[model samples]
Target: MNYYECMQESINYIENKIYEEIDLNEAADRAFMSLSNYYRLFFAIVGCNVKEYIRLRRIHLAAQELLSNDCSILDTAVKYGFTSADSFSRAFKKATGLLPSIFRKQDRQYMFERVDIMEKYFEIQDLELSEKYPDIKVLKETAPFYGAAFRAESKTPENDAFIGLKAWFDKNEIGNIMPDYRVYGYDIPNSAKDDGTYGYEVVVTIPDDFQVRGEGVVKKHFEGGLYAVTETTVGEIVKAWQRFISWLDISRYEMGAHQCLEEHEVESGFLNRNFEEPENIRINLYMPVVKRNQTEYGKVIVDPVRVAYYREYGSDSEQTAHNVWKVMLNWAEKNKLDCSKCKIYMYNHGFAKVKDFWFEIMITLDFAFQDNLIKEKIFKGGKYLTYDTSLSQLVSSWMKVNQYVSANKIASGNHQWVEVWKLNNWRFPEKGIMIMYPLV
Candidate 1:
């Protein structure tokens, strides 16, 4: 069989064994290739590894089962190799952005589409080296990364152009540095890339207390922020990069001064596993961003209120806010520290520049928490300007607030701005938000 046919045969085998534990070696044998050859070919064509592909297929089928049969979440999770309901829910939500319960309720397409293996091959072969637009996503702050940095140069294509970093890791015995096997590709700015070949730091995350002791190794912290993320494979990376830049043209955001981050084999499951080559690697591209246009949406006034607050440092404002409120609301129910008024105070002005991000998620408290970390603070009433926005429009809306402040000649007060989640649902706020900024 040809390459495509062999791949399709292997795909058929996977489909047949969707519920069962799939052995990679057996799949490779079915494809009539060694494990390495099968992995390389499949990743090249499918843009994911063997395990990832299986997860996608299994989840896709599980979605179908959830829709068609009267299956419980736990039963479905057990059937699909998920450990628990929470794990299944998290994985499902990560993939489809909806919980299995909600996903089952929605009447939508759930089946996995069969790949046209030959068609994709021909498309890639016929694809010219030209601009290819990427589907960009505005991601909220991500998990922090503490890793080592080094300058690297490309040498051999067969060895994935990562031989330099690999050599460095070996010489330094980097296994002693961190037990984790994940490797990240950090883009170095203004570095040499004369011919579409650039330098990057192939770094791995270390513990917070880990000390660095080596030549040319620098400890760097990627203070996560709002990022414009897109996926690109090694083959079309150059074109994909150009396309990402092009997307920024029409995008609501512009690039920031931060270096781009690429996710390679930077997860636990992927450690120690070698790909056929770096060219076969699929990477998610992350570019820091700022507002492109600052338009004033105008502002309104705020009122004084006593609130019970939970202060979380270095948290993603988007995701963490919801969880914080959920916990706080539950606490209020138990403690009777209840009031109808609830609003989140953003102290760091992450809406303007999201670095070293911190949040003070608060709910109305008649009495304060005696705990030092979670205490009550009175929002001194003041004349405030209001700008409306949502998580998606946060950056732009903040820019609008800035424009309003400049044009109206209003000085902001020392009081922290309040983000009002007025919607009945915090997870998906269809009506957006109101930011009440205290004026001087």
Candidate 2:
């Protein structure tokens, strides 16, 4: 069998005997390698030693059982291959920062999963460089980025924290887009001179209309504006980054209030031991900027849309919107219909923390979709009193706009009052909501 296939078989064997005393001899035998070779290979591709991995996996599984099942501490400990409760407690605390008893009482937002070491071995395609130089581009109202986040404690290149993220993505089948999707490395350094020793998040961008389901996952928008950009070949990333910083220093533009962005391409050459030739890798660095002579967000005139809508009632508008979109998308997928070209929208009708609120989520479908469950309506458009608002002040903002309309004696139209969402998450303080009051 090929090395990749051997690795897959080894992973399977480890998983099957996760709760048992996993023998190193048998694991190496599955990979068709000696014990030392197996250790080297595992550390290189999986990012951790085999024995450490086994312990980490056992602790992770134990966490799941403790959270979901009603078993005693000793029962859980012995069931997960631990000899004694004292040893299990110590190991669990070391693996995750939580004691088992305390972990059982809380609903953990995120958990680590088993790694699928196959991703690192796959064939990596080359990313063509347009040209190597100091380049700057102005991005206006770019789409929000959605992905998983994690903490990196140190600057050690061999740190295995990101392996869990890759494994989680693999388990969810979210890494299907290999070549097109770019993995981002976020580093908010205290001054750009810090040597990669900051808290980092390794994230993959979620595509539009794609479903994402996980905890600690968030949708964040990079403020649309001017940005200073630079590119570097894979092997000379450090030098390229330093040069980019120098370029920024000499540039006329000032830095905007956003974090640094790293776009990584060519997985084979990216900071891994599998491939050492840095010449094969390419990375794009983007830093948000404000022009010496600034700019502003321009006004947009939106036309009416005919949509099939779904309503979700709750206090949490963001969660309701997500749930409603899933229901609508699932319906479309179930009927074998294409929503690729369709525009999805959500309208917040109310937000009552103590009581139920209504959220009307909708999407425009072609005449081809004639489902009985979906109701259709046209959003009448005309001159509107447009104002930007957010989830926290949505109701208050609407009331103020209504008073303005009434005070001005502008007659109201018999159409649905529209609140177009500017950001994916309505909870975003800025650039979240655009309220449009229909006028006769």
Candidate 3:
């Protein structure tokens, strides 16, 4: 059997033996590889060692049972592969940093399943062969967005700035006026020399008549223009931004130089709402789009050579990931890489095994490519595709790519292909999966 087939067999073995004691030697034999070689290959290819992977899988299965079954912690632990509650607790704590009891107390509302499933199938595609361009119509009329925003230095999305904005809105009762205010991010034009730091604005829109006491603050108009808007519901607000960046990469329309905006359309009425309901909250990301143009509005930049996928444990996990991204960005800057050109993308998968949850974050770095030779080298094994998708059909568009690659029996190579997140701005989130193919 081929290496890919062996990998698939290994995954199947793990899934089947999750409720029982897993034997690595037996599994390796089943896959026709020596135990040592299997362990090495698994770690090298899957980013996790064999025993750790099995434990994670078991924990993942246990979590599902804890949510779906009526068994107690000890019983549940035994039903899975845990030796005892103590062993389970230690393992669980190591994986998720939360005790089983505490996790249970918070209830089963903590899982993000859809995002994980979407991510798993979206990253593999043969874009170079199936280049179907999107039929984008430049929006003649602009849509309306209402939210509260303020100016703050671009750090992480979970910086004190957001908390400060929330506090300011709550203090001034501005949220009462708009009722559903969201924090919107805008990139400042012609501010590249300042590391793109001076060029970003973190603002939210409110009603035109909303009162403000801050100096140098004004109600900016959202010019009605064409926008490519898509809606996604995320367990954390930060992942919403990651989803937006991923969509931008896969979409056909090139980003325009107009202001981008986000609208928080709260389904819960304007008062006393449950904060845990993922369905009641909807985030709409609007990116200005125009037909492909010769005059490039901005260049894409990537820096800081390291990349990893992270999964946030809960509501605060998003902020935690954001802060980590900021630190990485700062490190990249200190290393002489441009920060403004770098984008920290977050990919949220609703069905991957992360800790005891199904959410994982994929982070990538994009570097500046001045010479055509360098750009070609960077995208050396990258695949290109033109996707034809409507606003509502966006998720399915990615699935199409996955299906295409699987059907063609293409093998994933050593390195992932660089995906151009935005045709205009060169933006990519610090999370999510990207597919790359061999260049002819």
Candidate 4:
């Protein structure tokens, strides 16, 4: 079988055995490939090892059951081929951080419940894309928007929330325009929800002086900007996100801090109407991008020991690290860290490989923190490193520094500090924290 056919077969096997046993050898046989080749190809195409992928899929399924049914943890675990509750807890914790009991408890709060549908839909679809946009002309215009929005979980394109949007527009006597009129959907994180409903704002643009009724909040603004927009039919939302990612990769354009907007086009008669057919709906996805800044000349080299300091803050639990970074930056500035000669970098832990997820934050200071204030902090035994590096090479240099520290078995004692001093525009005098090793 070809690669795509083999993959499809394996996927079918996984789906059928989801509530029972999974055999790697059986999957390989079904794919008509050797075990080694299956393992390698699976990882290459899926971005995850086969075993890990199986576990992720199982966890996703268990989460859905927890939300949709009244099954106990043990029952769900057993039904899904888990040997015991403890084993299931460990796997669940690794995938979502919350234990089964905690997840059950939060079900009423609708946290897990709201995401269940999205999770299921995500499992059955391939959202990644190789390209985002072909050559398209750019257009700029200001638009007016009016609509009522509430946060609710939706997996299918056809949902009550979307239907409600159409109803609201019709009730307010708003008409749609070609190409410009669309629905802006925003995803808000770190917020509380009731019955799986969180806070969401939706805006639908209208013509001049068209005011929406119903005491719902309304706003108007200019939407003119460099937007990388793409269109997809009703069933192609997943592909659209992939296209946006591809566009970003090829164009080297950085995303600004803003919520993306989606414009939906439906038949004119469908206003405040429910339709069962998918072909009647269309969607346009827009992502905003801005130009990147060019690097300045003269860079510094940071010591490996100090790079480790930033690495530790990449953890999910490092709350105080951001404050520490601010203090270090202030010290460097007061001490005459040379902006021209040095580089400054911030790293976040838990970056998403496929979707939007990231871990902790890491900061690397090059020559910019060399003044007297920084020296005082070092003399006081503050936990930081002073390195010499230009800003442009900070990420790669830090990776190398990490490699060196790991190879040499260098210890970062209790302080665990890394930072860079800004001096003359030249990269030099990189310092790393020294640690004592435990005696065997």
Candidate 5:
């Protein structure tokens, strides 16, 4: 069978024997490869070693048993292949950030599942590129570059940009487009081109001593940032981009700001289309990336919710919100308020730094039961960006969402970001905090 099929078979073996000791050598035999080769292929395809995958799967199964109240924690641990309850608890805490006991009693449930290598491999749309997949590298930064940038800011900029730059080369008989000039290309980020327009910039790095010759080529410095880079042959470079993007989606990183680059290193013979032995040339693709937030979130539309609220200004939002929550609870108890939702909205004053921020604590209330003890208002719901996260590092998740809004150029419908407190937890997320930001 093929390599992917073999890996799937080994995964099947792992799942079947998770409650028992799995021989690494036996797993390799199932894949029809040496143990070392099997390990290599598994890591490349599954993004983790085979042993770690099995451990995670076992821990996941163990969690279910603990939550079901069907087995004691020690019994669950031993059944899932841990030698002792202590060993199991340590493993569980390392993988899931909580002890088995704490996790079982926690209000919010954690999401974990077995990896399906076969299905994941088959789903890659650019799987054809696997025949010659380029070796990828995650770079913290690239060297500073000063270059003359040629622009194609139009409705179809990608193709137009290349054509425009190529035409410039042809017009001047500029042999400089070759590797000697260090040429690069990228999609211009966040430009106002969504109105039936696109934007791309092609640049060739130039030395300080080099004389300028091209017309309408603007020269500038491009300070680089984090990038996932790969080198592919000229014939495969374009399609390689699609494959690279797919890789990033599953990886720990997400798209970030700045230029996503295609740096060309052409053979000396490359000028027009017909170059001698063209296969010798290569293109290095650079996809800007940032560490992804582990929080699960998406776009949602919320209907208007009516709530009774208390507003205050505080620098420490969480502590301040906690205090306001106590007051809100007292008010609700006094009024015998029936609530549908509990929410908090914190507003920014449109400044870089502020000593204090305005926050409102509220809960959805029955309109029929009027209460004069607090201010009642209808939260005019619209399209929003929302996420579900645990209390641990909750502030980082907020920072991530804000960064996402900025990186993606998201248009905000309002200045305040809403925190959705207390969910049902029976579904994807029932009893955890969900944060929502207004999106236009």
Candidate 6:
């Protein structure tokens, strides 16, 4: 077995016996390694000694038990292998910065969830690409990836490439692991032969320590970098590539040093499930690109508010967005709205074409204005990473935000991307806007 699978098995064993007296030697035996090797691998992969991981995991799980059940502190400590209540409290407070008593009363997020070896070392957050919205491109950066590349030459490049990857995994008895990894590929840049065929390489993510062996497969490493990504299905992929080329032609960023990739991975968290698949699997096309100019953007936090909004659907031109603001301000004027006390924010949405888009112009409403006539929604005030920049700097600012999100491992929630004008200074408002992305 590969080291990752062995480490995973040992982690599983430790988790199953978390409540019992865990033997470090026994854990080593489970991984088929010596005690020293086990400790080394565990520390290298999990980033903590097994004992520390167990203690924190106990505190994390105990925090849950303290809130849900009426178990005494001493009983909880005994259940999780702590010798006494005092020992448990010290370890818990040291890890969570709160006493067990206080932690039970307060609700907040914790970082001591059980460690999954595969996810910790190999997983990356994929930018959930929109298959239909050809205009809304997402900027993403992948870490240096080690993959098993399966080369294929065929008239049907996509199908042949995927087949080779799956067959290799199944033959090697690792097909079950495919769901936990990513599959990406690219057509040979300039290798179209006269036989009406092309070369495509399918890449499967592998652990850095895992060595691969197969007839037509080889281990390859990529120096991952920034990519402007979009999604399309098997039938419409040709158009997707065209869209990328067209975007780069006018965009501030040009293509970069790496090959463009088409990747597929399962998407998690809040999203439109309808766009996921209809037996027509989706593909995220990534174009490696570099910025032509350098600029710095400031980061800040934005508070949420209840807002009444007017949505306008129009072309992708700036004039359409301006018209949305005009319609919103006209309605607010008719209603005698107080702009000084409230803020206005706009959220743009993409459609099937770059020329078609939709935007919502919103005004924060007070408790007294709740009864007024307009569509109202409460924005769950949460943490956000934001920047103050002009409309022309929108793409670069969002790229900065994307970098922050990925670095911080922030999870995304239902779409609430907001760009607002300066406070009550609405003159030629497009000149200045605060671009904000919600963080969860």
TM-score of every candidate relative to the true structure: 0.36, 0.32, 0.28, 0.33, 0.33, 0.39
Kindly report which residue stretches of model 4 are placed more than 4 angstroms away from their true locations once superposed.
1-137, 140-158, 176-201, 207-223, 268-280, 294-440
Off by over 4 Å in 2: 1-142, 155-161, 177-179, 190-197, 208-221, 233-235, 269-280, 295-440
**Residue-level error in angstroms, candidate 3, position 126:** 20
Cα lDDT of candidate 5 equals 0.64
How well is each residue in 1-440 modelled by candidate 4, as lDDT tens digits?
22334555886786778777889899877866567656755654455677887787788878878888788999988877889999998998888878988887787322222112112211121123312233221222223234335333333323544555666666655542322344555433322222343333456655556544554445545334445556565566677666655455445343422345555543321343335665535455666544333211122332442321222222212234445455555544555655564444333321122122222223334432333323312211333323334433343234333333443455544532333334333323333222111111
- Residue runs of model 1 more than 4 Å from their true location after superposition: 1-135, 152-164, 171-181, 191-200, 265-281, 290-440
Give the lowest summed-lDDT range of ten residues in model 6. Answer: 266-275
lDDT score, candidate 4, position 234: 51
Query: Residue-wise lDDT of candidate 6 within 1-440, one digit each (tens)?
Result: 33454678998998999989888888988976667556755765577877788888888888888888888999999999989999999988898899888887786545678887656543233233233333435354557878898877666665666667777866765434432355677765333444556667888777787789988789888767677766566557788777776565555555554556776532210011122332354556777766644434444555667887777655333566778877777767767777667678877653122334566878887754543435788765555556676653455455555544554467865647787776454445445778777765
In Å, residue 230's CA in model 5 sits off its true spot by: 1.9
- Note each model's CA RMSD in angstroms: 17.9, 23.5, 24.4, 25.8, 22.9, 21.8
Candidates ranked by lDDT: 6, 5, 1, 2, 4, 3
lDDT of all the models against the reference?
0.61, 0.58, 0.47, 0.47, 0.64, 0.66
Task: Return whichever of 3 and 5 wins on lDDT.
Answer: 5
Compose the digit string of candidate 2's lDDT tens values, residues 1-440. 43334667898999999877888899988986657556755764577778888888888888888888898889989988888999999999888777888877876632667886435432221122113331433333233455554334345422333554565566666645422344566542221112433345666655655565555444443334444455555456677656654444444444454445666542442224243343545556666555443522223445776777777765443466677766776775675555445555556543222234456766666565566666778754566667665654455455445544543467876656667654332223335666777665
The alpha-carbon deviation from the true structure for residue 27 of candidate 1, after best TM-score superposition, in angstroms, is 10
Worst 10-residue lDDT window for candidate 2 reads: 122-131
Best by lDDT: 6
Model 3, backbone clash pairs (residues 3+ apart or across chains), number: 33
Better of 1 and 6 by TM-score: 6
Assess the local accuracy of residue 295 in candidate 6 as a C-alpha lDDT between 0 and 100.
32
**lDDT, residue 27, model 6:** 91
- Please give, for residues 1-440, the per-residue lDDT of candidate 5 as tens digits: 44455677888888888889999999988976567556755775577778788888888878777787757888888888888999999999999899988888893355567666545543232433444443555665456667767887666664565556666666754543322355677654323222555456877666655455666566677656666667666567667777766666456666654556776542221233233344445556776666676435698888887877887666443456566666766776676544344444433332233345445666776655555556888877788898776543244456556656765678889634677766332122335677788888
